[model samples]
Target: MRELTIDWTALHSAFQMNMPEVRCFLSVEDGKVQKLPPGDPNLATVRADPQHFIPIDAIPSRIQYQWLDDFIKALEDSVVRERMEAAINGKGAFRRFKDILLTLPDERRRWFEYRDQKMRERIVEWVREQAIVPLNEAPWSADLPEGSPPYVSAHIDEDSLGNLA
Candidate 1:
C-alpha cells in the first residue's frame, strides 16, 4: 500500500459533494482532490488512468441519515429527540433536521462534532480499501472499537433534494 499525505479538509469536501455534472478525483501520486466539471479536458485523461487518479465517491445519503438517527438517539432531551425523530421520516429530512439544529446552538455544535467523527472514520476506511495509507494525522486517529458496524449503502441520486446533511 502506498502512503500519501492528503489535504483532509479538501478530501472531506470532495466526499460530501454529489452532483450529476461534476466528478471528483484524488491524485494517488499527490493526494490532491480535483473537482472536474462536465466537458473538462482532463476528465477523459483522469478516467483513463486509474492508477494515478482515484475517483472519490460521495458519501451516500443513507449513511448520513444513519448518522442523524444515531445522534438523535444519543440526545438526552426527549422533546428535542422527538422533534428530530419526526424530522427524519420523509424526503426533506436532511434540511428539516438542520433547521431544528439551527435553533439549538449547543446541540448543533455537538452534531457537527459527531458528524465529523463519523466522516473521518468513513474516510479512513475508504483510503484503506483503495490500498492507500494516509500519511497525515487524521482528526480522529484513535483506533475504532472492535466490531464497529460498517456504514454501507447503495448510492442515492437525488440532486434535486439538495444537500444530504
Candidate 2:
C-alpha cells in the first residue's frame, strides 16, 4: 500500500478556505476528487461526469477551519464573525485573521506555536501509523551539532565479531 505524506507546516494555510467552497470541494461521489470551475454546468446545473467529485474519506482535511471559528468568536462576538466571514468570502481569510492576531503580539505567538505543535503531532502520528522510517537526522539531536558529520563510528571489542561466526 502507498502512504500519503503531508507537511504539517502547510495545514494552517490550507484551512483558510471558505466553508461553502471547502464543503463543495470535499464532497465525494464514485471515488473521485473534484475540481469544479466556477459556474461549470455540473456545479450550476447537474452532472454525469462525477469523476471530479471529492472522496468522502478525504473530507476532514478539506473542512477543518473551526480553530479560526473559535478564535474569532471569542475575540469579538458578532462583529468579528462578520469580518471573518467577509474575509473568507473574499478569499483572504488566513491573511485577515493573521492581521487581527498581529495586534496582540503575545497571543499571536502563542497561537502560532500551539497550531504548529498540533499539526506536527498529528503528522507524526500518521507517519508512525504508515510505518515510515525517517532517515535524516533530527535537527535537535544531541549526537549531531551544527557543522558536524552526519555519520559516526565507535570502537568496539573485536571479540564481539567472533559471536557472529
Candidate 3:
C-alpha cells in the first residue's frame, strides 16, 4: 500500500471550505454550536456543533491495548534479530533479512490486532467506563427468590444458592 501522510487539519479545513453547508453539528458551545466534549454521547450533537467537532478523517483511530505496541515491537525485533543471527551463521542472506525487517509493520499490526482484539477491546472498555448510564449489577446467586430460576441455570451447581436473599 502507498504510504499516505495526511495533514489532517488541512484536509479538514479544505473539506469545510469546499462543503461549508455540511449539516453536521460537531458539538455544543454554551448551548450553541461548539465541539463535542470528550466521550460525547451523541453524534447528532457533534454534527450540529461543527466548531467543536473533529472531522472523522482528522483523527488516527488506532485502537491498541496499552502494552500492544511494545509487545509487537519486541516480537518483531526478536524475529529480525533471529534472522540476522541466522544470516551471520551462513544460513540466509543479510539482504533478505533486511527486507523482512522492512516489511514487518503490517505483520506486527495484524498480530497485535489478532492477539488481543486490541483497539476494539480498549475502546469498548473506555466507552463502558465513561458511560453516563448506570450498569446493572449481576444478580447474586444466593439472593434469588425461592421460586425464581437461577439467572444462569446452565452454570448453577447442585450446592448453589439461587441469590443473596
Q: Which candidate ranks first by lDDT, i.e. highest?
A: 1
Supply candidate 1's per-residue lDDT for 11.
81
lDDT per residue (tens digit) for residues 1-165 in model 3: 111222323322332332333332212122122333445567565655544443432213132222333333344357654654454334344344445546777543444344332232232232233231212221232343356433211222213312212
TM-score of each: 0.78, 0.34, 0.26
Q: Of the pair 2 and 3, which is ahead by lDDT? A: 2
Lowest lDDT block of 10, candidate 3: 24-33
Sorting all predicted structures by TM-score, with the top scorer first, yields: 1, 2, 3
Q: Please write out the lDDT profile of model 1 over residues 78-124, one tens digit for every residue.
A: 99999999999999999999999999997887787677667776887
lDDT of 2 at 62: 31
Give candidate 3's TM-score: 0.26
Could you say which candidate leads in TM-score? Answer: 1
Off by over 4 Å in 1: 18-20, 139-165
Please identify model 2 stretches exceeding 4 Å from their true place: 1-64, 70-90, 132-165
Candidate 2, residues 15-111, lDDT tens digits: the string is 3334444323222222122444566666643244333332122224333355555444444347655766665544666777778777767546645
